[model samples]
Target: MTPAPLTRAAVADMIDHTLLAPQASPADVDALIVEARKLGVYAICLSPSMLPVRAPGLVVATVAGFPSGKHHSLVKGAEARLAVDQGAAEVDMVIDVGAALAGDFNAVLADIITVREATRDRAVLKVIVESAALTDAAIVGACRAAEQAGADFVKTSTGFHPAGGASAHAVRLMAETVGGRLGVKASGGIRTAEDAAAMIAAGATRLGLSKSAAVLDGFPD
Candidate 1:
């Protein structure tokens, strides 16, 4: 059976409209909220510091462990707990890429579990796996660890990593690893409608994009 063509509204609903730049000011986040509302996005992803923001009708997501996943697991858990307390409905926590790369999925699972316990059902948890920096085997391992740790989603990248961002192959692998049990979020460096469509076709259930309006504009209504 052929799949239906993706519509602009459908794509917008899949997007986590993002503004995670380190230098972004409170005013910039305010502007991002306005843009997200206008674009009809599902959520707005921001730094944890930007929490307590109001994006009525849109899910508010914040990051823990951030661009680098080197933080101690306890610290990441605390960050997630605090963000949830501050009104963030979702938390994307970065895992230690080094653990995955070193074939230590047990450590990865433990790290994610800490954050999962901290959120305690108050927020949806997405694990950022830094897929671009990992080998395909590591990606699979990381995704499996995320699932075993009870994350709600497994995200591709943080967009700040020097290596790269989301790709169709990574999204596919992640989706297959979780096997419909968890959402696959294709994030980072996705700037065009074509890119967004490809990720969806590859089994990404969610998207993370900094250029939400431009990408949505490229799609037909």
Candidate 2:
């Protein structure tokens, strides 16, 4: 039988309403939290500096190694640990893109493992692979490394890469690579409901969206 059509509410539940602007103030983050609660999103992804925030019914997520994944593994681990200590329930860490580009997936695995060990049982670890900047082989290798490193999810982009953001092609490739063993998150450049749906159809289990309200507005009740 065919699956029932997805609803606006269902899609909202799959979103991590995001606000990672470096210039954003506490007031802006407060407003973001308020909006996330009102939207009924599953989580809020913010920068680590804006953490320790509380959103009653939603998960709190933050990034480490951020848009650039050049940080040392130990540094990323420390950042993840601190984020969790600051009340973040989920930590997204960027894999070293240079390592992946250089075909050093073992290095990628080691990097994620450090963050995993730091978060250890305290928070969920999502590895951001920056898919748009990678080749298909690199995407697969990164996903595999993340899985071996004990990541709970494999995410596509950081929304800050000039290489651009999530694509259905990239999402599909990532989904196939992980083979449902881990959650797949499609982020970056996802501005419309149509883009969201395409990612979902391509096997994305979660979405990172800055334009949450605008995208949700396009869906039916």
Candidate 3:
């Protein structure tokens, strides 16, 4: 069965209006804050470097170990802490997909734990599992590890992975695994109201969308 339509407030609350593109300029960041304030989006996910100057009055967020979760755990942890100190309300850290696929579950757990500890008091931590790169089992494993590491949410993708974006199956798996304990963020390639509703129906409490304006524009209040 299809899900009911999401109210404007519900859609607004679920969005982490994102601007992670390399071409994102200072003016773009400024415009983002203006739009976010107008829409009252859940947060404005920005690049870490922009945190110091652009974080005020914004629900500031930074991506850790970013698109490619290949960075050393220590580096990700340090980045997480720095982002928090710079006034980030939330930190989205990518999991080491290589380690996860190789069955190095300990490495995956350790990586998320490092950032989890670093951001414990300062900001909420969301671990991006990059679900498209993993098999169902791997997704479950990552969700379990994220929950164990005290992550506030288990995110679906980084939008850079060639594997693709949020899927209903992946969202359901994440929700079934971590819904009650930790929130699920369905990100990457979400561009329409219908897509947003599908992800939410599949159990996404948060959505990271770069195409926020288009999505909301198509769904008038």
TM-score, predicted candidate 2 vs. hidden true structure:
0.98
Tell me the tens digit of each residue's lDDT in model 1 across 1-221.
99988899999999999999989999999999999999999999999988888778999999999989999999999999999999999999999999999999999999999999999889999999999999999999999999889899999999989999999999999999999999999999899999999999999999999999999998889
Question: For residue 196, what is the lDDT in candidate 2?
Answer: 94
| Residue 166 displacement in candidate 2 (angstroms) | 0.3
10 residues in a row with least lDDT, candidate 3: 49-58
In order, candidate lDDTs are 0.94, 0.94, 0.89
Per-model TM against the reference: 0.99, 0.98, 0.95
Candidate 2 error regions (>4 Å): none
Clashes of 2: 0
Candidate 1, 28: how far from true, in Å? Answer: 0.5
lDDT of 3: 0.89
Q: How close is candidate 1 to the true structure, as a TM-score?
A: 0.99
lDDT of 2 by residue, 96-160 (tens): 99999999999999999999999999998999999999999999999999999999999999999
Candidate 1: the clashing residue pairs are: none
Q: Can you write out model 3's per-residue Cα lDDT over 39-123, one digit (the tens) per residue?
A: 8788899988777656455678889998799999999999999988988889999999998888788889999999988887789
